[model samples]
Target: MRLINLKPSRTNQLILALLPFLALLLAYALGSTARLAENPSDKLLPALSSIADAVNRLAFVPDPRTGEYLLWSDTLASLGRLCSALGISTLIALVFGMVVGMFPYARALLAPFFAAVSMVPPLALLPILFIVMGLGETSKITLIVIGVAPIMIRDLALKVMELPREQTVKAETLGGNSWQIALRVVLPQILPRLLTCLRLQLGPAWLFLIAAEAISADSGLGYRIFLVRRYLSMDVIFPYVIWITLLAVLTNVLIDLVRIRVFPWSELDKAS
Candidate 1:
């Protein structure tokens, strides 16, 4: 039987867009049941509601210690460390991936190795990475690189090489040199797709940063999670989980702005 291609219906469109919301709703419902299973007396919604009130105590309620509200400093410090690791990931991914993608032989040699390595849990390498780089900024930043760079470089390289050969031949025929062909023609075509790649990579890189910080750092979001566990402070760590998600959203939106600006042609095609 032959399958016919058709556009999505209104219901499908609505469901696709609302999919994440639906899944989260389902998860929360199931999670609430699971919590009740663990301890029947602990009603999930009321407990969450109580925690919400307690968070307000940071400003509204007085602290028992100095009679002042407990303002959070750990959150800010954790965010700073996250930003540092993220910065390292972006720079390394772009430079390393860009070069590898543009060169065929280099891509051939390194692409498979990277793909295989990426499949291995990046966290699994933390012990060795720590041993080699130490438990300072080096180990954490190095972990981010190992996690992000391989995939980024591979995608960027493939996208660059994916340009229509006819365009390259056309440019060469018009007296454009190798460098000129790459810069004027190849760069623009690939840059749009690369922007998409960059946006996608940002989330994963930041995710890895959290684990990297958690494993060894004395500070950062990961460190705060550890501290919270030590103190049985669940609420403090939970809010930062929300913060990480919000940061990813904001970063993706920023990249989306660049996509609109730098790749008007791609946007136009998408519109069509």
Candidate 2:
């Protein structure tokens, strides 16, 4: 039973492609077991079946009435907010990270601040941002940016510092001045790792999204989650989870697709 020896192949890839769906199935199985443990007389299996059925129903094209079903507008709205926030944070992270990371003194001065702020919890910023920026889209975007950028800065800075010294030296020797070496040579080498960090930040982005939307709005998956919690409805909970899970999967796939496009070398290396 040497699972570690199992190398990935086309079959593995296809199976792994279904892995997220498989996980949902497994979650359902475990949920039923937990329900049975809690109550011997409870109809756990039937409840699980109903939840699965409701998931399919709600997934259909929701009608014009807002609360009639899980409207696609809400999903798009949530995703749009995420994109705005994540986009700004990514750019800020890349620029500030590369610039400050290249300089030892800057890293010393700023890295501690970045690390400290990250520990404060992005939810703590929600009230202030909501007041200052209001319950507007700006507040939501800022929430995600605050949550995501610190980790980005930390990872990006570390990766930049970890880059091979020979690249820097060679650039300098080739008449590439300070700015030229960092912008032209160093950045290209580090962009792949930066992309990886951005991908990793998506989970935190979701957390911040909840914080942002929990305050105001009738729509979005996070708000829907809250609505279900009010009634203690596990069936309703499943739909929101499915929505988020699908979105996360799609976002990661899109990012990876773009990553492969931008750096085809990574794919080549993987194949080799």
Candidate 3:
């Protein structure tokens, strides 16, 4: 059999998917054991047990000062900022992307400006945003939008431009006006790609959110991580990092499921 034709069975695929994570856990355990054996006071590479203890303290136990579960509070704050920014980004992308892709005059007017804006580093603008918007949720959410929206706009615009020209012509032949063609044709075709562009922006959105939170915020996963670094609290930091990863993964899965459920034809397009 050709090498490319040798596909794994479902069981084998599941095992293959798990192997890397298992190896990573095993390596961390061994490293933690070795480090602790040499120095019981080691702060780095904390034992798995210590990580579990930190998770319990942060997640299950209420904070003495605030009387709230720290992990849950931080998660909520971070997610609130993330979701708000992403929602704004999606709306901006959809509106501007369609205008640019469908109308030549709009494309000529705005495309170059957005391209230039996208090139500027979003983090560099963080200080400016804080100075202008102040160190509040607004600044943090704005930072995420600035970092993610332009790229999404460009991606969705390009996807719109790539759509078959024939379809537009056919719609016009059916006596559809500009708005009617856009509503009945371009909008439906680009929606799946919009979700896809949003998916691709998730990692960058998280990065921008974390950066903004680390620099200025009262509560968030990123803020907590930076707050503990002063004491070299690896156990807390490691678990928080893992929790963030799990949250991002869960969100990605949910978005994919929505895309599949709402736009089953997108999957068929891919298969063809």
Candidate 4:
């Protein structure tokens, strides 16, 4: 009966998770109905049917100019940029974070710089990125890297630093050199933490990608949303926004599955 031990059944848990989303839909429906009753031409909060139609059109119909479905094209473009940036960032974070965390000299040299870089506002660097990298996919991907890399690096370095000193000492005592210890002892422990950091970085990564796309890209969810804003097409915009949210959620879920499958020990540690 205690609150700490209370556990809801799976059915109840699913309902609890969905309750807020249902409430949100109901509220929006009521609001849209009220607005339409007053002014049948209201576009600010379009009816559910209007939004559904817009989604169907964008997702199903091919664009006349590009001969590709806008929704899928934008999703593909954005996902490519996102995955590339994140892959580069992860490699950079893993290398630099391990070096910084393991070596005192490196830690002293790079930790402060990373801390300062993470503090800089990523959006403010959009102009610099475009100017330096040009208005292309490189710039868009670089924006995401710059936005999320520093923080991810810092998180990973801290995770590595938190590894017990006794383990490193034992590895050394067992004839393991720094390289051997790092690869065999440290890397395995840190991999799960790295995935967790990447999952956490998804939000900021999406923000930077969207900002870059909005400002310059020819195709992306953000570009599409901004392109339609001049016409005040809330239906299209709302559905696009929802789709983006779903994409982010799906990415997080995938990372969780990877962690569960690849590092089940990490989950066991957490549960204990």
The local lDDT score (0 to 100) that residue 243 gets in candidate 2 is: 71
Task: Summarize candidate 2's per-residue lDDT along 55-91 as a digit string, tens digits.
Answer: 7666675655664557366687888899888889989
TM-score of every candidate: 0.72, 0.80, 0.98, 0.96
Candidate 4 per-residue C-alpha lDDT over 1-272 given as tens digits, one digit per residue, 9 for 90 to 100 = 88999998999999999999999999999999999999999999999999989988999998888889999999999999999999999999999999999999999999999999999998988899889989999988988888899998899899999999999999999999989988999999999999999999999999998888999989999999999999999999999999999999999999999999999999999999
Return the clash pairs for model 1, or none.
Answer: 78-220, 97-153, 101-157
Instruction: For model 1, state the Cα shift of residue 68 in Å.
Output: 13
Q: lDDT per residue, candidate 3, 170-226, as tens digits? A: 888999999998898999988988888888899999999999989988899999999
Ranking by TM-score: 3, 4, 2, 1
Residue 56 of model 3 has an lDDT of 97
Model 1 per-residue lDDT at 15: 87
**C-alpha RMSD for every candidate:** 5.0, 4.1, 1.0, 1.4
TM-score for candidate 2, residues paired by index? 0.80
**lDDT by residue (tens digit), candidate 1, 165-256:** 78878998999986687678777777677678777778777777777777777556667676667755555555556666777889789888
Q: What's the lDDT for residue 122 in model 1?
A: 77
TM-score winner? 3
* Cα lDDT, model 4, residue 252: 99
Model 4 — TM-score against the truth?
0.96
